[model samples]
Target: MKLLIIAPEQIPVPPRAGGSVENVIHQITSRLPEGHRVTIVSLRRGYLPRKSVSGPVTNLRVPGGSKKRYLANALRRVKGLAFDLIQIDNRPGFAAAVRNAFPHTPIAVFMHSMTFASPPMTTRRKANADFRHADLIVGNSLSLQRSLMSRFPAHRSKIAYVHLGVDTAQFRPSGKRRRGGYRFLFAGRMIPRKGVPTLLRAFKIARKSVPSIRLSVAGGTGKAAYRAFLRRTARRLNVPVRFKGNLPRKRMPAFYRSGDCFVCPSQEHEAFGLVNVEAMASGLPVIASRNGGIPEIVKDGRNGFLVTRYGKPAAFAARMAELARSPELHRRLSEQARSDAERYFGWQLTAAKLMELYAERLKTASAGRRTK
Candidate 1:
């Protein structure tokens, strides 16, 4: 198949930034069949208005002035190239644009997550428009699909769940185990939604009960005030928190290896907790809030623990304490977590599933054209 992928911006096959969406696009494009031709149409630069990506990509840089230029680019491709499918991984704005560009061409929109819960009016409108126009809609988790259904009931049949896969080879656990108590790790951006502050509070509570326990907080937005607040909170609470700001993706294995457990304290609707899966892949048992699709991956108390209520630092702390005291339980959960990730979240299996969906959609499109 000649696949044309229109991303929000130019990202390398294995993305270093842009969060999980970048990771998903990288995985699919990198693992696509060799015979297939893959072309990426994206913004020249994320912030600047450029013409093309420098790397090895078939770049059609938006001319200038408006996102409408993106529509013009898609129209040019539809008329100029013989593409089998177009996969869009961004907002509905792109989807509506593509539909206008190639009305007959089969377009599939990949929904990495939903924004309805906290969506702006424009976003919601575009999401609904994409639902009406796209031939197929792929959701990263059941939670995303359910949220879509509640908002756009008419497009219920169009939504399909495709769980995101993790790279076990890269994210697999390190064998080195440090002596003394468990070292807890928090990776991800230091944003409010991520609940970094909540994690700090929980860590403070946990430190009171377990003094030997160590904490590492990774990632940052360079929010100076926010960073200062966190540091001051740690000092006031007397918590031994190491604010090791932003580690590179390649070095993540080392960070994961250094920790005994991984915690994601996100308080909002997380479409899919990719971090949870990555932690499980690394053989570190996960402890995350039961919000969003986290429960879908973790079998609470089996592979990891799940905190239900939001803002419950005491409950979060207590769970950490339980895992810390129970060595046998920790061992069992860690082994099981790795096994589960290997069995279900491997890239090969994920690629195969994606191919199956692509093939099915292609066949349907072909049949519909013949019938008409």
Candidate 2:
């Protein structure tokens, strides 16, 4: 089968910078079945060739001035190419444009978030049209699927859920935990929706019980004001915190290995917490909020604990303290976390499931054409 993937304009495929969508595209394409051919279309800055082949995937770079213009140019460039399926990654506008341009081709729009599920009139109309045109709408988690269904009940039959997977081989356990202190790590944007403030307050409270406990945060400093606010909150609480800004993707394994436990205190309805899986694959116990698809990934008392209430610092703190105080429990969760990641979440399984979906959709389309 021939596959064409439309990636976000902000980042490149096999992302040098941080982009979950691009990373996922890379993961799926790299692990595709042996007989398949894949091509990726993305926006690149400055003057670069319009088309080129990178490794096994053909990359077509469009100008990055405007998303609408880029999509228009991308469609023009791939006008004559033949592809069995067109898979778009989390861009409703692009999906709509591609569906219009290639009416005969089967298009799959993969939704990573509920950004378009709820809206203020105009957005809903566009999102509805995008979903209505696509042959299938793939959600990365069941939480996202349910949200999409609630917002657009008419399209529930077209919606499907597929869990995101991580690279277990690269994020595997290092067989070493920090001595003398329990280190808790958080890796993501430093923003309110991520529940950074809640994590900070929880850390402060946990420190009261376990003084040796430490917290490290690593991610792109989203807003300058948010970074300042986080720093001030950390000092005001007198909790020992380390802020490592924008760690590279290559260094993430070491970052995960350096910690005793992983914490994802997300207040927003996260579609799927990829970091939680990465940390679990690193053989670290995870403590995350029971929001969105997090519950699907982090099973409470199995891999780690989940705070049921959102923004409850006290509950989060209690979980932190429990893991810090009990070494046997921590070890048990750590082992289970890695085992779970290996058993269920891997790129190979993700690719296989996707291929099965693609094949099914193509077969049904062919049958419809025969009947027509």
Please provide TM-scores, in order, for all candidate models, with all chains considered together: 0.89, 0.96
CA deviation > 4 Å runs, candidate 2 = 45-55, 120-122
Q: Which ten residues in a row are the worst by lDDT in model 2? A: 115-124
| TM-score: model 2 vs. ground truth | 0.96
Candidates in order have lDDT scores of 0.76, 0.87
Give the Cα RMSD of candidate 1.
3.3
Shift of residue 63 alpha carbon in model 1, Å:
8.2
Range of the 10 consecutive residues with the lowest summed lDDT in candidate 1: 48-57
Error of 1 at 43 (Å): 4.0
In model 2, what is the error at residue 311, expressed in angstroms?
Answer: 1.2
Q: Over the stretch 1-372, how does candidate 2's per-residue lDDT look in tens digits?
A: 899998877777767757888889988888877788888988875445667675667878777667888788778878988899999888866776898788899999888888644464238767887778788889999999898888878888888888889899899999754676899999997767899899999998898999899999998865898898889999998888999998878999999998999999999899998999999999999999999999999999999999998589999999999999999999999999999999988988888898888889999999999999
Specify the highest-lDDT model's number.
2
